[model samples]
Target: MKFLFPIFALCALLSSCQALAGSQAGTEAKFAPETITAFAKNVEKYAAAQGAGAFIIGRIGRPQQELPKGIRFTHTAIAVYSAITLKDGSTVNGYAIHNLYQETGKPDVSALVVDYPVDFFWGVHELSAGIIIPTPELQQRIIAAISSGKNKAVHNPAYSVIASPYNNELQNCTEHTLNIINASIYQTTDMRQLKANARAHFKGQRVRSSRFKLMLGSLFMDDVTTRDHDGKVVTTTFSTIGRYLQQNGLVKHMAVFNRDGSSGELL
Candidate 1:
């Protein structure tokens, strides 16, 4: 049984990392092509306005089978922006995006890698996105955590589309991101202790799914264990994390652009 579980876990990771293509049919985009294009072009501008520090951002990417509810964005990534000076005495702005990338058809916990927003939004299905600029204190903590490899340490590599929001044992992209945020705040890489603290600090959203969807998830995905959807209904997502930060006063500023091309403050 133990060996079998690992095999199943591996299968799930492979399916998640490689086939990032949206599982849900591309729904009608909320913004017209021009609007989404312009938004992508100005991503750096918006990110820069958050200050040259470590922050987090999310985008409405490939539609997954688990249709989101009351959430504006589905995928999340950490953005660390800084300035670079070239030998020619010119300064340029650049960003290193810290995110979890699932490899193609691999059954292991995805690793935390630095990806640019251009690459990050390659397959985005919507024009909407959200950015969370952490407080100065929180920003330093996040940067420290990443430098100390806490982000890599907390990742489970096993991808679960319907991973329990509370559990850190099996993680998806958002859960992995959450673990990193929690670990950074606590200043520890100890997974058990972080999970314990998260129980109190993190409150996930209650999401409901149909039996058909649950069955499909269970049959194909190894990480979506029976415990995922049986009892607790809450799941961690981009919006939930933003709400948590905003409610806790850890965020300095938050901005969200809806599918309608309208922009507003999240906090």
Candidate 2:
């Protein structure tokens, strides 16, 4: 909510913000067509193994400079493995992945959108992915909440590639997924409840950026001001959400899918 345009202008006099945005435009992952097809097939195998339900699938893809150190997986999405009916009395069955998508040309704006397994893996920079299959009881609640549009309500459109786990003023992809997951489990989407639940369930580390990095962030990113980050640190990431789910007994098992025709527990 705080603006550092004065400092931004001062810094821009030395460097261009447009250049900074351009340099950080590393969200879209570029994988080969064959790799994408294999990835989708593998994802389907794992989803079907869950036996007709919903689960959370995390992907390790492209990285951005804004993300902190040692964070491998960069994105998380909810995949519903169920048969859906259409108005024409037709039935569709497959993994329907839902996640926040940052629109083109909108800069820091994003919204929740659905993507199929193949569509989800398209442009993913990496071929490895982590699949977290929830227990049967939890899967039903998760699928219902997401299907009813209650999950998207917890998302904040003001996207930040490095969003904090403590606040809802802004959100990143992983942070948005964490909120929706928490809301579904806790049965509430209220802001205060989400913040409280995050404080309790979410756990991870954030690397405090150096003074120079902080200065760069303040100058380039509107949501990355000094007051908001204190030191331009980021805690809400894919690993954090995974840890929360594992600790809370929501997950049945976790498997890492590789492009080399192999899969195993994340460990």
Candidate 3:
């Protein structure tokens, strides 16, 4: 009977979602495409209304009931204001999401993808959105960093759902987002120094550990690994990134938005 809980936990981890970093293949959309498009449009509009040229975005990729303890959003990435080209070859100004998406059918590998908000939220289970807007100066810096191609240079395609922020051994979407943030701040694309800065100031979320859970994780090391941490399993998360920017006085707003366009505290 005691083993049942661990089995369920393992199922949750191996199911449609991969931690709070990115979504896996075979996930279904709870909302219809039109509904998703509307909600995504509103999210993009909200960020622009806040004067956010660049911001961090998170989504609830998995069912809330299946999420692990202390994990809220399931996928996170960066959104930048840009002129987006449509299928008709006409361009419109809006926010474009930059994602480190786990390759379809290959959960262990990821790729940097530039998509719009509708594409970002297309597979979400819920209509909720998490947003972290950096201060104006920081926003400009982030935009500049991405513009200079530093964001792409810092991306490590080796994907782990619970990747460590203090090292570049493996990376997920959230860790990648944090890496780009630090790159923008330090004004350098030096991966080693960026990792050093993260080690100095970042506080990653510690995955609640147990002997049985650790055993299960080991069996699926391709998806979740703790070799990066000598102690507890400390992995970068959306909340950790929010806390880092909030504490450093680089955040203009940290908030959550519902489908109804209501606003609330994120963390």
Candidate 4:
């Protein structure tokens, strides 16, 4: 009976191990294109309900105003009338704006660049609500690009339509909305603490951090800067400091400046 008991215990242990392994394997296999598609569709429906479309356009260094006219939507554009039905018996009307470099003359082989969120309107509020439906085909293309590990440079000019009066808020409000959306998309961390730390470290000191890097990360560090309260120039080292901030998710859209005495001001 003792020997039988020991054998039973061994069987139970093996069964438990097998069950755990199976659970892990199931989890590993749970990546589904349908799931991604469903999420994209839901976002689309929400954006439509908000009286906006999905699709956004902006360059890293350029002013949002400079976005091209062709990319902007007009009331007459075909995309506005197109509707996508959602699982909840609602429909979203919009089109997907892909980031592709517009070829000057040749039209066949436009390369893919960094994919950004496409919003229906010029304002961040409208853009934030825009739904980008990543169809299974789109997902497959993105996966292929990821597997290649290549940086696709998009040369197409960004397109946009005129801003509606309904979305034209104070410039600061627009800036704030832009920052929030960008941070959310990029998975940036809360900068309340990091900004405080940076201000404490760089105030009244000739430090090397670019205004752009201080805000958006190394990706756009080369294009941003600011003068310290004491009139000293601060530059960010794109290779080192910029990368460091980016990896830590401390990069934000707000400017970090030396406040009165030793405090950091996030503007």
Candidate 5:
């Protein structure tokens, strides 16, 4: 297990999605359940106050030090404000996170999961959150994409931690989020054209791990791979996505929502 540290570390830094490589990566919770629940509610309240209908939410699924130079979040998902029915049959307004989670045992595959904020932060490494509130038009577009089932059309079950955003050869959480947004904007499920648009306008975060370490990680973890990427490992990250939306005037606001009730600039 000691020798596997380097392999896991490489995966953690290069991965744009959740920490799914090591045994405890996705299962361990840094804060108590009650504390996480309170923090999750706080994030939800903050987004609601901003009038965010649909926004991007990011979480740190691994220790901060394990993250690389340009990466801040280990996982990202789309959160939509909607009415949720409780176990007791009562309904209330809350945010529902749409995520691409690696199957519990099958790390190479993923599934679309709709969960609440508390569940979203239950297995996190930190209480902080990355939020990107899309503009009113884009928010409606995103909600439409999800409701029309276009989101599932763009999902690739063959998961990769460092999937290229410019192509659909493989898919990760961030890429899926981008795909859904593009589907909404372009009003099409054409993956090829969506990817082309991304290549033209979006600049992905370059992965800085060495090839030797990358290869080592691929040898051990099913979700770790750089094969789809040719030379430089450029994949969509939460920050890059925020910048893309901001530059295109599709974002209403973006910020880092911390547990201490303070906010910081996202870009």
Candidate 6:
């Protein structure tokens, strides 16, 4: 799902809340302990309804708006839910949910908090084709264990759940292996070292044929290598291979590779 905007906004708002709290002494505090505790119980109930091994991971609560009768609240929580199967061929479904709340601004200002709800709940009889499926006997045991409010069942080893679409995309790219050879090269003045690093990293990976042109930019070029299935390296060279490396926490900069083997644009 496209959760980028919402997640980013939530993170920013949460950070602002923390900054505001830190700046003022006793100016704001998290939600009441009783409210958080009740939220936790409700999370467990939600997990149990979904046949999940429920457990709360984290929580943050804050006061939002104050009404004449009670206080408005915003909270964020994380939970883990799981299903397990035992060795004796029994299955159990379980869930865990955590709830957190935080006050946005001062005592009675417009407050907002981000909720991080992670559900690890899965069911036995609700198996989908091509998805991870536990054995029938294992599923039964999991169901039995969760029904009794006990979490002792062992989950099936083959029951791999797909967390998200990005995970699936990464898994599907099994043909080529991508790696970062040198992150510091982009900051260096040496062109030869950068080229050498790129060559070493890109060699012997099975990349798509059409990606060659897209890989060649003015600043950096990609080296394509073809190898046999037996792990034998065959050919390697600087090719216009079109492959983009998408990373989360990397410092990205564009550099220029001159025709005369010079390096420029170190930014």
User: Which candidate number maximizes TM-score?
Assistant: 3
Candidate 5 Cα outliers beyond 4 Å, as residue runs: 1-26
Write candidate 2's Cα lDDT for 20-48 as tens digits. Answer: 22212235548776768777987788668
Q: Tell me how far the alpha carbon of residue 49 in candidate 3 is from the true structure, in angstroms, after superposition.
A: 0.9
Model 5, range 43-155, lDDT digits (tens) per residue? 99999999999999998777777676688887889999999999999999999999988788888888898988888888787888999999999999999999989999999
Clashing pairs for model 1 are 10-107, 14-105, 14-106, 17-102, 18-104, 108-157, 109-156, 109-157, 109-158, 110-157
Q: Which of candidates 2 and 6 is the stronger one according to lDDT?
A: 2
**Clashes per candidate, residues 3 or more apart or on different chains:** 10, 2, 0, 17, 0, 37
lDDT for 193 (candidate 6): 49
Residues 58-168, model 4: lDDT tens digits: 211112243222211111100122455658999864544333332333222233333212321222211112122222332333333333432121111221111111111
- List where candidate 1 sits over 4 angstroms from the true fold: 1-38, 62-66, 83-92, 107-109, 228-230, 258-262
lDDT of each: 0.66, 0.67, 0.84, 0.27, 0.84, 0.24
- State the number of backbone clashes in model 2: 2
Q: What is the C-alpha RMSD of each candidate to the true structure, in Å?
A: 7.6, 6.2, 2.3, 22.3, 3.3, 23.6
lDDT of 2 at 89: 100
**Model 4 poorest ten-residue lDDT run:** 20-29
CA lDDT of 117 in candidate 4?
22
lDDT of 1 by residue, 20-57 (tens): 32212223555455665566657767666657488787
TM-score of every prediction relative to native: 0.76, 0.80, 0.92, 0.22, 0.91, 0.19
Candidate 3: which stretches are off by over 4 Å? 1-21, 24-27
Candidates by lDDT, descending order = 5, 3, 2, 1, 4, 6
- Candidate 6 structure lDDT: 0.24
Q: Regarding lDDT, does 3 or 4 come out ahead? A: 3
- TM-score, candidate number 2: 0.80
Clashing pairs in 2: 29-123, 29-125
Which pairs clash inside model 3? none
Lowest summed lDDT window (length 10), candidate 3: 16-25
Candidate order (TM-score): 3, 5, 2, 1, 4, 6
